[model samples]
Each structure stands twice: as structure tokens, then as C-alpha cells.
Target: MVIRISKGSILILCLVLTNCKDSNKKLKETTVVSNIEKTLNFNLESAIADCQTQLERAVPKLTDLTKHPRFIEKEDTDWHQVPNDKLMWTSGFYPGILWYAYDVTGDNKWKKEAIKRTEVFEDFKNITEHHDIGFMMFPAYGNGFKIGDKKEYKDILLTSANSLATRFNPNVGTIKSWSNKMHPRWKQHITIIDNMLNLELLFWSAKNGGNPVHYDMAVKHAETTMNNHFREDLTSWHVIEYDSINGKVLNRHTKQGFADDSRWSRGQAWGVYGYTMVYKETKDKKFLDFAKKLADKYISLLPEDMIPAWDFDVQSDPKEEKDASAAAVVASALIDLSSFVESKEEQVKYLNAGIKMLNSLSSKKYSGVGKSDAFLLHSTGAKSLGWEIDVALIYADYYYIEALSRLKKLEKK
Candidate 1:
């Protein structure tokens, strides 16, 4: 066939060819992307099933450990009375797991128990001037209030938030919690990254109660922690010294570790979880970037199977071992940190690392199974106190369930 074109028709023909080429290129790219997504979808389904199994095993123990004034003894025989004092911290972790179980299984039992047990905080009005009130309150009441819409939880949260806000010392630009009459060194208002957890309560309270000042106060505390508590490398000490009288940053030190500069595994885990949480609440790129930086460094330090010792830098020639509890907490935190990553591959890597650690814990050697202590496997409390060591710790259960919850959410997504 003879084809004849005028000058105007020539331009139109060129335009048509260009448009067809562009469309072809676009379609090819779309097909590639679709294939990649399909591969990812398949992998996620298999990985999620494996991850869910481990998390499922964690739920029952997390439940029994957080109940009443007692837990099962390791002797594997009977229920032992947990000191009335210890119950508060243990109780702090219950609601999150309960709610999570409900979310995953749609189990009314889980929701019912969660709602019922969280009521303990209703009568539990006293807020301790401690670094752990976030873990001690939010998971029980603040989370309950936020998720379940329980008025009692809200009331408890408001009271606790008021008390927490009061702990903010203007001079230190942070909350003052650690103090010991017997040990004068423990005195003075200081900043620790761990406070990042509790500061969320302040944010929650401010948003819920129409108080902007509480939010601003929380920002100040977090800023102070960001500036002072972290080292130049962003690895953190357990404590940072401040001039409580003048609100000046003084020094960074370790409170519970072997030395001021040595890295305590659990302390770093707290940093990992706390800063990631701070990023989630604030949406500040600085906090998110800082969290990613810390997570990168922390993840690099994980041993085989991604579990870390209590102290990452501890020397082994003298036979000092790592704290398994620290590994558990960090593993849990890493699972949360995974959600914040920009890349699917990075998220999968962190998720896999967490799963590796969890699988190791489920193993016979470290889990301390059949012992009946209501704890999982490894924890090291103050050896100076002659207390917990290599035992399943409550916070471990908390993070375990928290990680599991995150995994469950990912599965649904």
C-alpha cells in the first residue's frame, strides 16, 4: 500500500509512534514490578506462617506470667507467690498481649481477660517515681484506654500521666526517677534514653486531655535525651548525668552495667525500642534517622542467630557471658524497628533476625522449658542483689508478645 502524508500528518504520525513506544516501555516496567511483587507475596506467606507458630507458642506463657500476685515456680511443681511489689511491673505487660491475642484470633477470652486484668490499675493509683512507669502504666492502662476505650483505663492513665509530668524537673530538662538513699551516686536528676517510652504517655495525655504543655514538655525531655544520653557513636549509656539544679548536661555514665562506658545489652535494647517508638509518635525525621542509625549498629553486633549477649563488648577470656534477656528484648525491638525501614528487603532482614533469635529461644538449651518458673529462658538481674539470672524475664515476655503482635499485623497487611 502507498502511504502519503502531508507535513501536518507527518507530525501526527511521529507523535503516535512516540506515544506507542512510551506505552510499551511502561507496560514492560509494570510487568517486571508485578513479577517482583508476586515473588514477595509468596515469600511473605511462607515466612509469616513460620513466624506465627513461634509467636503462638509465646502467648500462653506471657499470659500466665502476668497474672495475680503469683507465677509458676521453676521447680515445675506449684504456684509461687511473687512478691506483691513485683506484680506491678509484671501486670504492666498483660493488656498488650491480651489485646494482641484478640486481634489475631478474634478471641473474646483474650479481650475479656485483658479488660478485666487491666482494671487492677484502676485501684492502682500510686505512680512510682521510677524510670519504668511507661512500661508500668501504658501497656496496662494507656494502651487499654487507647485501644479498648475503657474509661477506667483512661482515668488511671490520666492520673499516671499527671504524676509522670510532675516528675519533669525544669532544672534537668528531663524526668527525675533514679535515686537511692543508700547510694548517693544514684541521686540527681538525669536523662536516660529509656525514658523515651514513658514520654509517650505524656504525649498521649496531652492529646487526650487538651493539654499542649504536656506535649511540649515531652519534646523537651526527648530532645535532652537525644543530645546528652547518646554517645558520639549513638550507642547509649544507661544513665546521663545532669545538673539537676541548673538543667545542664554533665556526663554520660552507666548505672547497671559493669562500667560507665561498656555497652549493656538491655540498655541498648531499651534504646532501640524507645527511639523507634519516639520516631513513631513524633514523625520527626531526626528521631527516625537516629533510630535507624542505632538499629543498624545494634543489628550489626548480633551474634550468630541474631541474639546478643547482655553486654555486647564484654570480654570472653574471663568467661563473662552475655545476658540472654538482653538478646530477647533487642530481638523484640528489632521486630518493631523493621516496620520503620524504607526497604522491603531491610524489613525482611530484621524480621528474619528476630525470628532467628526467637527460634533459638524456643530451643531446649536456652528456653529453660519444663522448669515452670513462668519465665522463658535467659535473664540477668543485678547479680549484686542475688536475684534473677538466666531466667525468663517479664519484659522479655512483653517484647516477645509485642514482636509477635507486629508480625501478626504484617501478616494481615
Candidate 2:
């Protein structure tokens, strides 16, 4: 070894060593990328772990909220503020989380809590004519059925579906947005794309409960929404007009957007996810095509970190008030849509985009360490409604898990 020799030989040896080091570095980088891809592909074990930790921390807070129950009066965190009695709708979302918690940890405590929480709503009929019955009912009861195979949960879901069906106005071709009890004169009005989320439960109800009318009505509402709610750019409006008595398009309005003409961020997200879900259920090419188009528009506008501003078209400097919930919703729905795409490239595009958004969220800013709340991050509510700057909302948590579940399922397959 000591006989080494000329400078040329030494130079050659140095070059080889450097080359090997460079190759190793490159290999490490590639491995990191692969791990990220695996994370995106959906690892249920990890997702379940994250979900359980969040749930365990959040449950005590929920239990505290119900110490005294009343309509929209039950005390909750600042962001998730709703009446105790009316908050029963949110109770639906919790069981699914609880179920997830139970499923992941095999914890009897989670199972008991889920069952007890669901039992509270066993006779809890009388759904308010809000735009989120699906959120209210499906998470609480629909998921409850999935978790435990309870007939009562199934029955309540069907009943809620029936109530939702009644809210449908044949004239508007959409479900009336809200019950007039909150506003005497607006007895039957069509507004909000949020209802589209709830309509899927109606489809489920029809299929599971033998009511074709419910499925038909859900499709009608979805069709009505796609035609009227979406703007040319695939942006969406929060309010629209429908001849409630005749099911005809009256006009498009913007009650919730920044202006009657501005594109609201959450509303756009609602449209993207809703139509995508509709496409999944109905296999309607129009809906799927529209979903892809809107998704493209949405992804194009995303900020550097992938979280969207509360309103995409808002001219003000980007605000942290941006909705993380929207990203979660879109990601979860995109995963669902991925299965329907025949092209592997197309599937990867949608799924990868979603994974990027979720990973960005899980990083420092969106999901802080020891946050203790079940929420992932980013939720904003109407200031006039006294819910501005709400964080870690229930819906955000729900969809975040949903996205996680979809990703995890893909990995297994």
C-alpha cells in the first residue's frame, strides 16, 4: 500500500472517492423522495396514530361542551361555537373520529365513548334545514352504523335523509338552503353549494334503505348546483336563485363571497369536492370532467405552500385566515376521484397533489406540535355570524382524516 506511487494514481483515487460520495448523496435524496411518496400513498398505521392522538386530546373538550346542553348555546371552543342542542349535528362527526380511534388502538374506551355519544342521538331527529346535514348526520350516525352495524344508526340516517329530501324544492331543482324559521320570509330559497356534501348521504340512504326517490333527488340537486353555482373559471358562488316551486334556475348570486361577484375560497372548495363526490356516485362524465377542470383551476392558484387564501380572488395580501379545511376536503375528494381515472399518470397527478397539500399542512405551520386539538389547521367562519377566525373546526378534522384514510387505503392496494 505504501508503494503507491505517482501523482496521477493519487489523483485517480481521489476522483473515485469523490464520485462515490456524490452517488451516495444522490441516493439519499432519492430515498427521501420515495419516503414522501410512500407517505402520500397512504399509511393507515400512521394516519390512525395521528388521528387517535388528536381525538384523545379533543374528546375531553367535547365532553366539557356538553356539560350543559341547549340549542347553539352549548359552550365549545371559540371556533367550533354552536348551540349545545343544535350542536348534536356535530355530534355525528365525533363518532366517526371515535370509531377511527377505536379501530386504530383497539381501545375499549374509544368504543364505549363512541357508542355512548351515538346513543345520545338515537332519537335525535329534527335536523335543522342547514346546508350540512351530511356533515351532521353522516359522521355521527352514518359512520356509527359502519362502526357498529347498529340498525338504529341506520334508521336515524334514513330519517335524516327523508328530512333532507323534504327540504328539496322541485321548483329550484335544489334543496332549499335553510329553514325559514331563522328568517320568516325566506321560507324556501336555494343557496349554498355546501348542500351538495350532504346529498351523498341521501344517495346512501336510497341504496341502503330502498328509497329511489332519495337518490333521484340527490342527483337533481347536484345537477342543479353544477349548472348554477360554478362560474366560468370553475370558481363558485355561495348563493343562487332557483324557482323553488318550479325547479328552474332563477339566477346566480353571491351572498357569501367577498362581493356578489367575487370567488369565495371555501365555496370553491365545496364545489370541487361536492361535484367530485357526485361524479364518484353517479359516474356522470360531465361531473367528473367538471371536477377535473375545477381542480386544475384550483391547483393553479394555490400559494407556494399549497394552502389557499380564504378567497382566491381577493386582492388583499394573502392572509393566514386561509382555510386549511378546503385543502383537506379537496385532497380527500381527489383521492376518491383518482380511482375512477383510467390513466395511471392522471391518477398519480391528483393523488400526488393531494399528498403535497396534506404534507405541507402536517409540517410546522399548519399542524403545530402538541396542538392538543383534533383539528389539523385552517378554518374561518363568517364574522357577522360571530365565528370569524375559528381554528381546528370539526369539518376540517373530518376531511383531514378522510384524506388520510384514502391515502392509507391506496398504499395497501
Candidate 3:
């Protein structure tokens, strides 16, 4: 006898098979994601050891405390030193790296070297020709005071904040980033996104016994930058020229990006890190929201490895250089920003992004082990000017160590 099946039974059988296939596909996707996360789980202790080894190699090569490593040229084994006497903006990062090493390893030698290197910048407080005094002083003295609680470091930081405040034009509501003579085309008061990082010194000083005007200056500068420096998409312009007398934006342009309409990777990183720091100091929700927007935009533009090109809009050539310094800076900032957000989803997203970037930097592909004296390699600085491209930068090492230290602390929490 032939058994007859209803059309309804056949439809039910088909639906069950379809459901099983969908479930299998989802299970495979989840397994892939789990494998990626596990692979990206970095070894913090080993990463820190690599940094210590690099620092050990670097210290013996420092012939003068006044001369600090800025960047290494391509195929060069030795770091090119720049004199602190010139008040170079990159000076503090070397001492800051030493301080980070000291923090991570509890090594007295790194502390001694950090103090020695940092003391060279004591005279920089009096040089207020530009707005980079914070960058020159904070990493050395700010981290020094935080770690050692030295009164001298606090006094130096306060003095440096005062000098930075002098560059803030009340009318323009922002700090002048460069001197007119330096950029004759920008005849008016000009501010760059990098200036946002300098405001942290002012915010810290105001809370730690400096004048309240420093705080006000920082807030105003951040507000003005938030208003004028960002496009609708939250990508930042490298420079904003303002009429010093009228407090009006005169021009929105680029100094280091591919074009005036393009986004500079380091500049965008500065905005992300700076706004996160500003929110931390002020506890303002607006700054925090703005920082999240900046961070999301930056993260969305990154390649699969979580590293960005020197500029986002540069023609996508196979040889396009990556900015590990920018990645390091944003990684450190994202870790800090992760802790500040209230949403668990957002916190996990940011923390995971930070970790992924750190993992990429710590891998053999980026680590400077046995190849250079720096902790990481392939950082681009001002590619438009044929400056330091795909080389080791001191700030990259500083922030990479900072991010690792932060992750270690966060793990404990």
C-alpha cells in the first residue's frame, strides 16, 4: 500500500531543514568571531618586556640629556636626536616613554633616566612663542608629578600651563597654534587640531592650584574647536584660521593632510584623544558625546588591521604608509574612553577596538624588536612635507606603553 502525505506535512519538513541550515550558519559565524577575539588576545607582560628591551638599547646611545630621540629615518639604525634647547614639540615623549617603562617594570634605572631627561625641559616653561609648551612639558613633568609626586614637577607644570594660556586669544576663543611668521599664508590667528592635546595641561593645572583662567581657556578652546574644526561627518580640518579681533573663522584648510578637504590621520587621532581627555577633566557629557563621535568616525575608517593610513583621503595606493603613532594615540585614548562610557555595549566596543589596535602594534609585523631601538615602527609624521615616513617615532612608543599599562590596570579592575 502507498502512503499518502499531505501538502502541509511536506511544507513543515522543508521549514525544519531551512531552520537547521540557518542555525548552522550562525554557529559558524559565532565560532569565527570567537577565534578572532582569542587570536587578538595580546600578552601584556611580553609586550612590556619588549618595550623595556628597546629602552635599554636606547639609553646607552643617548650621549646628551638635552638631545632626545625624535624619529628614526628609514633603514637607519640610530635615532636622529633633536635638541631640547630648540623647544621641539616632540621632546617630552622620550622622557614620557621612560616614565611609562618605570611604571610598568618598577625599575629604578628608568626612573633615574626619566628624571634626567625630563629636567632638560625645565627651561621650556619660559619659551611661549607657540602653543606646544604643554606637549613639551606635560609628558615629562605631568607624568613625573603623577608618578613621583614631586613638588618641583607640579610647579613646573603650573608654570607651563600659564605659558600655554598666554597663547589663548580671548577674542578668538582658541589658542594660537603657530606664529604668523612661521606660516605667512595664515596671516591671522590659526589653531590646529593638535592644539587640543595641549589643553590637558591647563585643565590639570587649574585643578591643582593654578589660576582658574587656565580652566576657562581650556573650555573655550575646546568649544571653539568643536564648533569650527570639524566637518559634518566629524572629520577634522588640520588648521582653522580666525580673525583675532573679531573672533570669526577666516579659513578652514589643511597643512598636513592630502588636501584641504581630506582628513589627516594624526590630526583626527589628536581630536579623539584630546576630547576624551577634556571630558575626563571637565566631566561634561557634551565633550564625551563629541569624543564618541570623533572616535566612531576614526574607527570606521580604519583598515582591517585597525591601523590607518597617514591621511584617510590619500589615494589608496598599495604603498600608502600607515601611521602607527596615530594608532597608538587612539588606542590609548579609546581605552580611557571605554572606561568613561556608561553603556556596556559601547565600553566593550571601544575596549575591543583598543585591544585589537594594541595587538596589531605588538605583533611581529609592527614591533621594532631586533630591528630598531623603538618599541613600534612605521609611524608617519607630516608625510606631505617628505618628513619622517614609515619610521619609529618616540610618541608612538610613549602611547603604546601607556595603552599597555592602562590595559593592565583595567584588567585588574
Candidate 4:
């Protein structure tokens, strides 16, 4: 067939060809970027060694082992240690970091320091006014037992789990995260998403010869939080208030996010970590499914660097500050979650996502290294409360080291 094309039609064909060429270039560029991300080198041993060096410098500065180091403010050169008499929720993290260091290096000196720091929380097992006994004891005594299998450490962990159980009201179906005195505005029995992490102690203790009731309480709390603490999209609220008498959700709010409905980065991390752990302990498919949903939502919303801002819904500004602590928690949790998933595809995706996060954390941009004694930098702790913004938090260091240790074990396997 002989056909004559008009000038306009010829122009249209040329434009279409140009657009196709542009699209092909973009596709090639994207593929290269994806390949680069997949092949990014993450030296787990070097990262752990860097952490050990940081800890070696930090331990000497902590002259009083009784007072745990908490954070280093952006403007300060020294750490703000938790007061000796005060029962801080973060008291166990310092010891936990030491324990992880010992695990990674198998150095007797790290073990000795870890034991000294772990013993400081032995009396914390009896603290019953709050739900943080898990935070205070598990990382200290729980890790101690896990490493050395000491009878004393096991006993302390059991006692700590029991104390945590006392805060669980049968009527509320969740443990009280804060006492009335702790937050006067939260007169109703308040439970924070962070409470999910404390359930691990109960689950472990129940399996290790404590009251089986501890297991039931942990499951009940997980179920209640699973039902009430999450939005339809699966992002979590930092706090949920409940009616103490009848087990009803009274209000959903946030203490550390941009607003009441905003997704706090650390709170979501807690959900991912907590649900993953709950599924591991219970072997319930429902919990595992919920954990995947939580992790998926979190992974979906992370920034390009794999680190998240303090609040996911916060105004998008380059200087808005990132939460390395949240990244660390999610990294550790994702590594554990990777093992639980049945599909190999899902396993590799989660595991690679976790390693990518750890790689970002290990970089000099987020790593404390020579800048501070803490292991990681730029962690936001309760930014809405104007506290610990852009600081190196003890918990961030704890989880970073924990993630590294977990990754090391996976490499061996």
C-alpha cells in the first residue's frame, strides 16, 4: 500500500518516538539504581567493631556504673545519666548494650562490665507501680541469663515479669503503661504501644517456669493492642486510653508524635517489633499476619535513606530530623520477622530491608563514631515534648548493637 503522511502526522510520530526513548532511559536508570541498592556492601563485623570501640571509650566515662547513661544532647559533650534513685524506663539499655557487646566479641572484659551493669537492676524486679519493669529488667537480667545462664539472672527475670503482670488489669485487658501519678491528664488506664515490648518478658518468663498466667496476660495485652492501638491503615497511635472498669477504649492520642493522630516513628517500630515477637512466642498466624501488616506499612513509609523522621506525617522538610532509634528498632525487628515468614521471597525482602537500614545506621552520617560515646546519632526521643531531640539515646545504641548481633548470628547460620 502506498500512503502519503501529512506533516502534522509525521511530527506526531517523531514526538512519540522521542517519548519512548526518554521512557527507556528512565527505566534503565531505575534498574541500575535498584541493582546498586541490592548490592550495597554491609560489613556486619566492621559495624560491630565500631560499636565496641565506641563502647570502650564510653564505659570509662561512665565512672558510676549505678547510673546508666541515657543520652547526649545536641549541645552537650557529656551524657545525661539516669539518676541513681530514679526508676527510669531506659535503665536496662546500657547494660543491654554491654551484653550485646559481650556476645559479639566473646571478651571477658565486656562480660564483666555487663554483669556489673546488669546487677544494678536486680532490685528493679520489685518495682510494681509501673509497666516498665520489663524495660528495666529484661535487657539487664534477661540478656544476662541468655548469655551466661546464671541462676540469679533467671530468678530476677521471673520476679520482674511477675511485677509487670501485676499492672495487667483483667478488666482492661491490657497492662497499664503509666500510673495515674505518672501522667495526670491520662486519668483513664493508659496503654502505650511501647507496652508491646514489655510483653516479651512475660512470654519468656511464662515459658521458663513462672506463672503460666503471665503468658495469658501477654496474649491478652497483644490482642487488645492489636484491636485498639492501630488505625485502619495499620499505623499506630502512641497511646490509647482505656476504661479501667469495663475494658473499653476511651481515647486514642499521641504524646510523642506531631499530633494526636500522627504516626510516631518509634511507636510504629514498637508495633513491628512487639507483634513480631508475639507471633514468635505464640506461633499464632493472626499475630504473624498482623506483624507483617505493621512491618509493611512501616517499610512503605520510610524515607529514601531507610531512616524515618520522628513522625511519619510531619511536614516534609530536609532538616526535619530523623529518628535513628526507630530505624534501629525496626531493623532488629525486621531481621527477626524475616525468619518467621514462610515465603522465601518475603524472607529475603524483609532481611534485605533490615540490612539496608543497618547499613544506613552504620554510616558516618548517622553513626556516633568519634562524635559522641553513643553508638548512633540523631535519634529523636519524645520530640513533641521537646525532649531528647537530635540526641544519641541509650535505647538507640542498645537496639543498634542488638541488630548487629542478630545479623552476625544470621551470617553464621
Candidate 5:
């Protein structure tokens, strides 16, 4: 297949080249790619080929020859791209999936597609309204930096970290997750369990520039979340409403889960992934222990196939929609956490658990192979709200690919 880059994309290419430091600019522009063998002993060559075909099919539908994909809009059961701006939290994962594909398959096709998609986010580095800049920047630009060694990636990520840091209210001891335009049920200062995952962007910024405040704020937010977000049973509240003025805990409720008290399966995944990631970056034992408890609870609660219903308390039917995205996140976190455990038994337990989740996701029923949807399957995105339910969420695809990449690296050890 011929590589297609329009004349307009050439401008984006030049801008991408010039934005970063000249000395640090490196792009591995190569068409030859050797296939990477999966170390988890999972045969993903066929699956990845399916992903490549779907993505290639998806590219022709682009209205803007320059910009890459937004999330697929479901017209009934079919998924197709509808244009949207960069105001969404899942924006980065599209390019992120491409980057991971590049890393795993060494395919220049994925790299080129990823770079084009990444260029669209150049203006978003300065956005500060929400705490999701990390979600928007890091996986796309961060992977670009890692793959290409571009100074542009570093600069954008640092700026995004600063943008994320701006949301940190010291009085509340946490970063506000949403803008004021969120659901009216939320307080002005609502710190969510998912925000725990964004601290990595701040921590990355602090490490590179020696910014002490970024580090301090991330630590404080983790502490605050540790103190407030969890139930006694170790599951998480989706959102914790706070008094913005005095840092008082006003009420703990959910904006995304099934009910105020129901366990949102994805939120549980965030708790495990975020705490595990924070612990990985900080070496904080408390966070690691906390992550373990949440992961264990999640594992114990999983239905026989290891897939979780969107919310544990919301659905009783075995056929209810499941959040495979959350399952993927937990699988990726467990893979990382396995490396950190002191006990060999626990390590094997976590590792095997991750492999089990991956096996489930990769199965024919859920993998969405040869499906017209053009994304992975069995992902329940806010099923209770009737939004993106039982669809292939891009974030789920990102973390699923990420898990495979992490597994590939670990298998080498």
C-alpha cells in the first residue's frame, strides 16, 4: 500500500520539525519494521493485523485531510468518525494507540499515522480549564518524544503539566478534575478518583525541570485522595465533592457511575492504575499497598471470565454490559504491580491475573475481530447514562495495547 500524505500535511510536518530543539530532533522515519514476538506467549500477530486493517480503513473517512481521528460515533450499532474539537479527555488515546502499535510492531505506517494525529494536539498544550491535559498530551506527545526523541514532546508535556498543575487548589489539597461546566450535581471543587492517574504528567514535568512544587502538589493530591476517595471496603467513589473555600469535604458522590453508592468498575480500575503508577514513580509503599487492596478487591469481585460489569451494584444479569476498558486498565496496572511486590507468590498472582484478563479481552467474543465497528469490543463507557455503551472505546484500546507493550518488555527480562 502506498503511504498517503497530502500537501497540507506537509505544512504540519514542517511545523512539527521546527517546534522542538534542533539539537534534540530525531525522527525514526523508516518503512522496514520487524514484528515483535509477544512474551506473554499470546499470539497477537493476527489480532494486530486486524487492528492495522481497521485503522487503515478508518483513515479514508477523514474529512480533514490533515487531522486524524476523533472517537467513533455510533449510528445505531455501527461506528464512524464524526468531527469534534480537542475538548475531550480521550483525544490523546487515538495517537497513543498508534504509537504503541509503532513500538510493538515497528511499523512505520502506525508511526506516520500517529505523528499526523499528534500534530493536531499542538495547540492544546496551553489548555488549562480541565485536569485532563495529561490525558490529552502525554500518551500522544509523550510517546512521540520517546519514539522520536523530539524536544517538542518534552516542551509540550511540561507545559501540559503546568496546565494540569494550575488546577491544584492547595486549600483542597487536590487538583480539580473538571471545569465548572460539568454536571450541576458536582461541587465547584470535585476531585475524582480518575485524577489520580494524571499526576504522572506532573511528576514527569517535575523530574525533568526540577520543579519542586509540581512534585509537592502531586504528592499532596495523592495523600488527599488516599484519605478521602475510598470506601472502607477499598473500592472508590467516582467523585468527591469538596468545599472550594475552606477545603472541607462537602459530599462524596458520583458523576459517572451507576448510582451514588454503586461501584463504578472503571473507577475501581483507575484506583488501581493511578495508585500503582504513583507508587511506581514515587516508591511510596503506602500507595502501593493501597493499590494492592483495590486491585485485590477488583479481582475478587470479577465475574468468572474476569470481565466486570460497568458497575457491580447496577447490574445483576450475567449478560449486562461490561467495561472491558476498565478490565484493560486493571490488567496493565497488575502487570506493573507484579514487578513491585516483595512476595513471589503475590507477584505470580498479579502477573497471572493480568494474563488472564488479557486472555479474556483477546477472546473472539470480546475482541471485535472483523467487526464493522473499527474499534475493540465489549467496552461499556458509562452504560448507566446510555452513553457509548457496549462499544469499543479508544481509551480501552490504548491501555490494551499498552498492556501488550508492557508485557513485551517484561517478557524480555
Candidate 6:
């Protein structure tokens, strides 16, 4: 306006204009950062795209060379086919992976591959010796039934539940994990944290009109596990031997972990996933509360990377390897667990923990999705104590896909 004004007034007006310009720039910069945070939070679409790419690379190698997907990438990345009749604990996961690939990509190639791999498990549905029927059938037949609702898939799952039910010892109040004769030192019965996983089969059977005994068996097994398999801190033991005559807990031990008193990461994952499953099937508050307790204990012990060592008790050893598969399993379970919690803070805590793990798993450090024949690598299975160490395991691949698939669904909703 060029009106007459004092010198000090002119300087003050210039200072005010400069401050306004600085404030606008700061606001714009903050807005850009906020947008970046939103974009980077969890991109489900990009994750799914990465999965499709990973599967396209990984699945063909599995199907082209092997009649059954064995998953221990051998010489020349040849699909090392394991005998389907061996009844390995992870036999079902291969087919499950195929099913998931089919689910996410809607590719008939993956579906046909899944079906071909699943057909071999026809014999698995009738075998009753072990407690991995859920692991063996659900990922294959359960997803088969889910994707198509085929009567055959339903029938196989039902029959497998019956076979699994027969292993439940009424005298011991839990499903026999393995033959008592195999581990006769217990002299009664043996159950494991792994057994909790098998209860999903029983629950599904009971809910789907198979048998009430299946349901009863599941409840009893879960109750037994909740009482004996867990310690005061909610960390689980791998196995619990019981007195066959009186159902008394004979001893608690660890078969696949660092020590008897140590926390096996996968075993804890099994417990968390199984109990959350029980709650899902029964809507039981006790199971939900127990799952939350276990989740809290697990989250508290997570290393800086948010991944767990093969055993929580391996703190004494700097050479201890991280169980990325266990982390994947727990991450998958936590996504589901978050939905059951009534508290918002608890829900956010669980969900963020899962998202952090999924992010870590997808990073270059842990995700060797395309580098080798395996879809996901850096998984430490059974550590150096067992045959497989720092290798890509079929279960690890299965659960990694599963966790991604789960988060994608949640994001869509």
C-alpha cells in the first residue's frame, strides 16, 4: 500500500511474512511424510504381487520334477520327492502351499498341482498313529473343501478326523502323540504341543457333523495341554508324558528344543495357534485368554528383529539361529488372534507385532524368495541339533505364504 510507516514497523512486517513462509514449508513437509507413512504401512497389493511372482517361480520347480513335493531343494534344485507313504509330519503342508498359491493367484495350474499332490494323502486320512492329522490334512483337504466345498474333500477330512480320534486315550485324557511302545520310558501315554494342532481336525469334524466324540476329544486334549504342556509363564514344553492308568502327568520334557526347561519357538507357536483355533471353534473365553497370555509372553521375549531364536532358552549361545518359520507361524496366528481380543490396545499390539514380522520376513535379509529354488529361506529348522539347519523347510514356506495371504484378506476388508 506504500503508506507512511515507522522503520521498526516495516522490519516487523517483513519478519512476519518470513515466519509465515517457513511455517507453510514445514506443514507441507509434514504432510509429505504423513503420506509416505500411510503408503509404507502395509501394502497388501504389492505383497500379493510379490507372492504371485514367488509362487510362479517356486511351484513349477516343485511340480515338474517330483510326483510329490519334498521341499529340501537337493542337487540342481531338483524337487527331492519324499515317499508320500512315509507320513512325515509336514506331508500336508506341500499340498497346502499349492492350495494357497491357487487361492491367491486364481491360477488353475496351481489348483491342478494341489489336487495331484493331495491325492496321495488318501492313505493319510486312514492312518491313525500320529497327531499331525490336522497339519497333514487341513492345509490340503481343508483348503480343498474351503476353495470348492467338494464332497470328496469333506469326506476325506471327516475320515481323517475319525482316525485321529481313535488315538485319543480316554485313560490319559489326551491324544497319543506317538506310540507308547516307541517311548516306553513314559510307560503310559505321551502328548505334545504338536498335538494341540491336531485338535483342529477334531473340532472341524465335530462342527461339520462327523461325531460328538471328536468334539469331546478336542476339548479334553486342549484342557490337558493347557494344564500340563505350559509352564507358569505360559511357555510350553514340547512333550508331556502321562500315566496311562490314572491320567496323571508323569513328566514334562522337550524332544526338539534346546533344553527341557527351554522354550521351543515352534512349540510355542503351536500352542498359540492351537488355542486360538480352539477359541475360534468353541468361542471359549478361557482359550482366548490363554492365547493372549501366550502371545504377551512371546512378544515380550522377541529379539530386536522381532524374530525368535529356535529356542527362547538359547540366550546363552550367540550362535543360536532364528526360526523364521516359527516367527511366520506366530505372525499368522497373531493376525487371527487380534480379531478375538476385546481391547483395542491389545488388538493393535498384536496386529502391529504381526505386521512387523511380516515386514521382516519379506525383507531382503530373510526373504530369498527368488534367489534360490525355495520360495522363502533363512528358516532354521530343528537347529544344528537336528539334521536340518538354516534351511528352507516346506512348513516354513507354507506358513509364510499363509501369513501373507491372511494379512491380504484383512487389508481388503
Q: What tens digits encode model 5's per-residue C-alpha lDDT throughout 1-413?
A: 99999998999898877776453322211100111223444555555666666666665555363344433444332444534355677778888888988887888878887888887888888888888888888888988888745666787888788888889999999999887676677747988898988998888888888366998999999999999999899888998988999998988888779888889999999999999999998998998898899899999999888888999886577677888899999989998898788876787688778878887888787775666545467777776677877777789878988887877666554
Error of 3 at 45 (Å): 1.1
TM-score for all predictions?
A: 0.77, 0.81, 0.90, 0.90, 0.85, 0.86
Q: Provide C-alpha RMSD values for all models, in order.
A: 6.7, 10.5, 10.5, 12.6, 13.1, 10.3
Q: In model 2, what lDDT does residue 198 have?
A: 86
Please identify which of the two predictions, 3 or 6, would achieve the higher lDDT against the true structure: 3
**Which lDDT tens digits does candidate 2 get at residues 209-254?**
6478988898888887778777777787777766656656656655
Candidate lDDT (C-alpha), each: 0.63, 0.68, 0.88, 0.87, 0.79, 0.78
Positional deviation of 14 in candidate 2, in angstroms? 54
Q: Write model 3 residue lDDT over 1-413, tens digit each, in one string.
A: 99999999999999999999998865654443344347787777888999999878878998787588999886986789987764488999998888888888899999998888889788898768999888888899999998755667888888889889889899999999999998898999999999999999999989999999899999999999999999999999999999999999999898888888899999999999999999999999999999999999999999999889999987276589999999999999998998899876787788889989999999888999999888988999988988898999989988999998887666645
lDDT order of candidates, best first?
3, 4, 5, 6, 2, 1
Q: Please, what's the RMSD in Å of model 4?
A: 12.6
Residue pairs with clashing backbones, model 5 = none
How far off is residue 348 in model 5, in Å?
Answer: 0.9
Candidate 4, 120-168: lDDT as tens digits: 6677889898888888888888888887566677777888888898899
* Segments of candidate 5 deviating more than 4 angstroms: 1-41, 44-50, 60-79, 82-84, 373-375
lDDT winner between candidates 3 and 5: 3
Candidate 2 global lDDT: 0.68
Instruction: For model 2, give the 10-residue run with minimal summed lDDT.
Output: 68-77
lDDT for each residue of candidate 1 in 1-413, tens digit (9 for 90 to 100): 99877999989999999999998865654443334435434232333343245344444544443344223323442333353242245556655656655555565766777786666555444565565566677887765675566765666777777777777887777887565552367566766656777887888878777357778888888777877777787778887877779877666776667678887777787777777777877788887778778777787777764566666676343355446666666667666776677776776666666666666655555554455433355556543244554455555655655565565555444
Q: Pick the winner on lDDT between candidates 1 and 3.
A: 3
Better of 1 and 6 by lDDT: 6
Q: Say which prediction, candidate 4 or candidate 5, comes out ahead on lDDT.
A: 4
